[model samples]
Target: MWANLALSPLHVAAGTSVGNGALLGLTRLVSLKLAELRITDGDCAGIAALTRLTELDLRNSRVGDAGVQGLSRLTSLQCLDLTWTQASSPPALSSLTKLNMDNCKVGGEVALRVLRSTRFPKLHAVHMSMVQVDETGRELLNAICSDSASTLDSFMLPSASISTVRFIGRAVALRSLDLTGVKITDSSWGTLAMLVSLQELELRGTNASNEVIKSLQDLVQLQRLSLRQTRINDGALPLLQSLQGGLTSLDLSDNDIQGEPALQQAWGNLQLLESLQLLKTKVTDAGAHSLKQLGASLRELHIGSTDLSNACFLRACEKLQILHLDGCRKLTAPVFQSGVRHLQELQALTVSDCPFISKAAVLEVQKDLPLRYMSCDDEVLFSAKKTEPIWKSGAALTDRLQELAPYDERCRYSTDELLSARYSEFVPQLESSGPLAAVLRELELVSTQ
Candidate 1:
């Protein structure tokens, strides 16, 4: 086992305890991760001989300050993760460029001392989520932001307060910031706008002021923004529209946006936008109509849970590649024959839960195009609730349905001659099955059976 100690990466067992026999032979490993292991202070002494180690992760481990000290001898270590551990004091890691101490029970003073004394000139990213940040920690953060703003560009500081956010804004060089589930209000918008270099920002499950969108206007370089499950409403749409030119991806899913009039007015203005998600929004046919402006540019569009009819897809999304129309209850067969089938660029389509659509229409489109994926389950069962079978009796209709039922069970429509000869056997059944009532009754029975 000791013969291969010079390997580039070494992974040990999760249950491995301190002074385990397997670890005795490994000393020349370049990267070591003892995450979620029973390793303690004494075990770290065995790993101290791996001077070539460049990465170490002791996350969720029982390692304490003594174990941390033992591993600190690795002068070449550049990345260290002590997440969810009890390591109170971290040694001065001059060579470390990335450090994650999220959810650790470390005190503010110890963290401050490390941050102040640590001399990682190349340090570019840090994650301090759920870490207790006292006044000293805040000062330490401000010092890092002011002194090393140029080198540091990415930060993940979820649960951070407004003061911490203010301090972070001083790092003008930041290109990415993740404050998901963080608590901050509109008051911090001005401070946040200082990150002029941010290219990607994630604020999912976080709430900020409507004025926060005003702050985002200065982020001309921002290409991607995720506001999923946020409290922003229709009034904030105009502010979001300011990022039309440079922004390519925007996620407004689970928001209370009833309409997108600002986006409708600026339809073609967002020429660079490639992906837009409006899932679970209160968008209706009007909202879908406004999306026509993006049909030529957007590669992926999600309008699920919106109240749209077949008319929405008639605009012809010439460049659209993926479309999601789930829970669009108003859609029917006309959407397929008139609108959707014409989208030659469409590679994937989802229309689940649209009870007005027919399995036949979905199948026709599937056969016409080489669609990579198509979901149209729960289609309409009948032309309507009333009307009698054009056929003589209920028994005759049941026999015909019994024959078509086999293939229809797998899909909404039959793929064999039964459906292929719709003009002959199928239409006649619909015409005889009252084109509505009787045929649907049999279909319901077959499905239930």
Candidate 2:
């Protein structure tokens, strides 16, 4: 009966061959999941016929090389999760924007060659955690700095990768870079400074400090900079003035940043700043008071686990939208209720692990504000909506989504595979020259003289 209609996301994990026959006519299936499923050689192989599938999750499934070979032609495929599979050769994923191949195979040599920026030109996030690379010298870096360096917005490699790419300095067209959990080599500091067009740079959980800050002074065009959980201290705060004119979002969370004279002196320079994250830093009441100066433009803020007892700073940011107040022992209920009512734009609020906030106080504040989502001391993070399917709840999901689509073997290598297999004909224009960059650059060139 469900076969006549266009079906949605389907999951077939740890199930017998009962409903597999009724899953054939679902040509509009957008997402499919088979993670940790007990399947044989040709069990769910018929899923290769779903041409419109944009996302697929085969993580932890024992589906070997043959199973993934069918997915290589999914041109509309934007995201793929092949975390714990035995597939050696990466299928030619032409339109992939995000990929997770964690612990697939060590020394990902063959995978590196296929990881060319031109191949997956739209590739944004690549997770190679727990996988070691055999590429020495500049092989790993050069593969990333290919012809399509412009379209690759983000390259999140949170693994033990240490290499100095000499060509990265020349790739000025490439700006948005994420080197999370990868230690920056001493020699690479000079190379990083050459990217003057860098608007978004994230060095979260790395070994970056003032020494690296000196090289980044030339990044006046930088807008979004995240240095969360690094070795940055107050000494580097002075250099922030160089990029303050253009920077909108700045994060110095979990660092040794002491908020006092240094916070007011250096931070007061940022007049156009928007979102700020100072979670778990050494910011005191003096630093907390200074934030009101930036309240006009500041929209999102995360100041959890600080030594500030006062919640009066929340009264200033009338334009504030999202806020996180987790692990703040000093925040009392009366103080929070009085301060939060000022924020008319507040939508998302997180107050987890605050021993001072009572449930009665939370409901009282809810009356005055229009908070869409709240997370604190509850199993359910959001509301009781159950908006999206829980992918990991294998058997439970399969029972609810029984009539997704019928499986078939005849159309596995259909005409859709032939078309999406080829690489893009033209190299996409660099995002740096895109519309948003043009608008931002125009704003930076605004003069006060």
Candidate 3:
């Protein structure tokens, strides 16, 4: 363990044998991630010794008030993530440059005061979801913004009753701001537009409308914008197009965007756009045809739950690499045979719940093309011949056996099938593992499978 201590972001979650105390001895560690270990006061003492740590993520841990007290000693820590930790803090994170205390129990005025008094000279990003910030707290934030020595880049203060827009306008260097579930009106959009350096803005679940869109037209460096569940509609399209060739990713999912003409007129103008997600929209093939105009630059496209057919997708397959047609029931076999064959660079394809796609077509495509990744529901069918099945039963298991069963009649298996019989399997051994463990396992399985 000491030999490999140079690896930053060392995650010792549920399954691994490494304890919290052993992890603490790696004083050279810059990033320590021990999430969902059911860590308590005793476990946090180990973390307190990691004085040189910059990023400490204890998310979903059972750490409580005692654990919070232990974290106060980590003065060198810059980024502290306590999301879903269920910890009632005495505000131990004063020197942190980035702090995420989302869904925690640090919402009172005392908590705010403790956070405000902290000497975060380089604090840049903060996430305080479900915290109760009143007028005074906003004024405190305003004071923090006025500090010329500090550089706050991103802030998420959902449920904070920040009424006035003037306070935020003062944050000249802010790049990303999320005020979801706040009472800020459309008029505040003008004030927020003054933030010249703002790049990614998320106003999801907000009351802001087309006015916000119009206000953001002047932000040239803006790359990613998410206005999910907002009142903004097709009227916002023109404002979005104003960004034109600059914006790379746009997510207007879960809105009332209807018909292809609106999307066509909107997206056809984003020439530099690479990723576009229009999930649960009223877009049809006509709208998809309009999207095809962007085929030259678009790399990742998601049209889930939309009224689209294979023909629409085929029209734009020339440059698509990551295609997600999940829940697009109308997709047919000819679509894969014709449309997918043209996508020479296609690396990952997902057609989950699309009853129209047959197993035979999937195998034929794997045999004919050089796809590196394919996922259908719980199973991930792949083309690698040396990999073994990751799971043997349940919906999580791939039906690859059934697909290969017919060819193998009493050792009559096809030579190619026999060579490719092994399927990579992923099964978690630890019950207390965090989401990251699952992700790592999946990634390892993907590389082998």
Question: Residue 94 in model 1: shift from native, Å?
Answer: 2.6
Worst 10 residues of 3 by lDDT: 425-434
Which segments of model 2 are wrong by more than 4 Å? 1-82, 87-100, 106-127, 136-141, 161-176, 196-199, 266-269, 372-449
Q: Cα deviation of 79 in candidate 2 (Å)?
A: 7.8
TM-score per prediction, in order, is 0.74, 0.63, 0.68
The per-model lDDT (C-alpha) reads 0.64, 0.61, 0.62
Candidate 2 local lDDT, 385-443, one digit each (tens): 22322133334323212211111121123223312322111001112222222322333
Candidate that beats the other on lDDT, 1 or 2, i.e. the better one? 1
Candidate 1: regions farther than 4 A off: 1-5, 16-25, 88-90, 129-147, 160-164, 310-314, 357-361, 376-449
**Model 3, range 14-44, lDDT digits (tens) per residue?**
5554456576558788887765566666777
- The predictions' CA RMSDs to the true structure, in order, are 15.9, 12.6, 10.3
User: Which scores greater on TM-score, model 1 or model 2?
Assistant: 1
Instruction: List model 1 lDDT by residue over 88-157, tens digit each.
Output: 6555666767777767554466667677676555568877666666666667666667666787888876
The candidate maximizing lDDT is 1
